[model samples]
Structures are given as structure tokens and as C-alpha cells.
Target: MSSSARPARRRLQRAALPISAVMLLSLASAGCGASVGGAPPCLPPEHTVSPSSAKPGDSVTVSAPDAKCDPRYGEDAVISIVFIDAAGVEVLNTTAPMADAGGFNFTAEVPLNSAPGVMAVNAMPHGVDWCDDTGKNNRVSQGELPLERASCVLPTKPLNITK
Candidate 1:
């Protein structure tokens, strides 16, 4: 190529360097957990029941880690536990508000009348009106409820209820 064309090509290549670097940095930041697409990341919170086995009227503690759903719903999500007996009857239901730091503990007595067998324990975001049983719309188990940034059906974990 001519000398004049060579200098113009060099100038264009130099200008592209900064733009490339910026795009790479943006990608790297997102890969490192920074929210992308101007939306906060939505990670499903996990639930754990201490002891996993409890006797009638015994106290059971449910623990949950920090979680995010929809940014519009923000950080304050209600956590609820539904204790169902072997007969599929709900015996005890409790809703606890989540703390600012996200982690929370909810302790409740296993109803003395809880059908003595393996009890099905389910957890879900109970703060939103449509996502809860108390809401007039009653979409509790619809599985289409939006939780923060994602949609999920409520999840259940099992617990041994001994006599």
C-alpha cells in the first residue's frame, strides 16, 4: 500500500484499541458477578432445617441464605414454611419476614397433631400477594409466580416427624 494509506490504517488501529479494552473490561466485570443488562442477578435462596428430624411439638429451625428475586421486589422478601402431613394436609404454616442482610431463621413448634410420619415441608416467597395463600387471588402453587428476577414454583423439602 502507499505511504499515505499506511499512516491512515495505523491511526484507525490505534483508535480501536481503547474501544476494545473497554468492551473487554465490561465483559470481565459481568463475569465476576456484577449485574449485567442493568438488572440485578437473581439467585434462588436455599433452605435448611436443623436436625431434619423432629418430634411432635418440638421446635424446628429453618435457615435461609441471602437471596435475590426481582429487583422490583427488592431485597425484603417474605419467607414461608408449609408443613404438610403424610395425608397431604397442611398442619402448620408460618411466614417470616426476611432481614436486611438476607439470612434469616424461623423456628416453630411441630404441631403436636402433625400427622406422625414423613412431613413435606415447602418454602417459597410469601410476601407478594399473588405468591401466597393468604392473598385473595390464591396463586400460591402456580409455579408461575415471579420471584425477584426469576420464576419458580415453590420448593419442598421433607422432614421426619416422629411420634
Candidate 2:
């Protein structure tokens, strides 16, 4: 092969990457409720945690107003919210089925065993544990979803668990 052809081949290979990625994204967004072609279509909801603070064991209302979903996900598709305490442990996982407007609202309890501090909560597709053992200490359980950015974490204000 000519040197010029080598460069062209390299360019073609590079070009194929984005094409492959797009194809993969398309198939993944098709949402069979699982990852396909190295992409996971986990569209996080536009949600709010009412009160922004709660006592341990207390419940707060979580609502998502314009929850977006790709064409693959049906109107009745489900979204799961994961609550991780300061210790990087998942306290609760709530699966909420979307409504006609593609949104969900529910009440979740802050772990009564959780210490008084900030907690992180995020929503993603059901079955994909996007935010599990958060501190990256490698204690995470199975089914952790790997995403290429675009994390769908909610809660504008820090959810402080009161003492």
C-alpha cells in the first residue's frame, strides 16, 4: 500500500468511529431496557426534591416535570431514582413509571440509618444503576451502567439529611 493510501486508511478508520458511535447510539436509544453496542440510553428526568432537606427516615416528594425520553422508550416506560448517602452507599432505589407527559412524581425516604449530611440522588432508566457506590471505592454492586458523559442527576439543591 502507498504511503498516501496509509494516511487515507487511517482517516477512514477514524471516520468510521463516529459513524459507528452514531449507529450504536441509535440502537441503544431504541431502549430495549438494556445497553446495546456500548451505549446506554438512560435519559435522566428533570426532577425536583421537595423541601430540599429532610430528617433521617423522613420522606420527601420527588417530581419530574418534563421528563424526556427517546422514541424507543414507551409512554409507560419506567425510571428509577437512586439515593446515595454521604458514605457512598445507595439507600433507596425507586422505580417510577412515566405518565403520558413523560414525567414522574414520588415520595422517598432518606435512610434512617444515614448520617446527617448531604446525599446525592439521580434518575435513570429502570434496571441501570447509574449512581451506585458513588465514591468509586469499588464496593458497587452489579449492573452499574457505564455512560459516555451526559449524567442525568437531579436535585438542584443539596439534599441535606437533618439530624
Considering every candidate listed, which one attains the maximal TM-score? 1
Can you write out model 1's per-residue Cα lDDT over 6-124, one digit (the tens) per residue?
77866765563332233234333211112335555443356677778999889988877765543233466666778877656789888887654345688899888887767766665
The prediction achieving the highest lDDT against the true structure is: 1
Q: Give me candidate 2's TM-score against the actual structure.
A: 0.52
| Residue-level lDDT tens digits of model 2 in 15-125 | 633322332343333222222244554344456678788898788877776534432445666777777666656688778876644467778777788766676665555
- Model 2 — which ten-residue stretch has the worst lDDT? 27-36
lDDT of each: 0.59, 0.56
Clash pairs for candidate 2:
none
RMSD of each: 19.2, 13.7
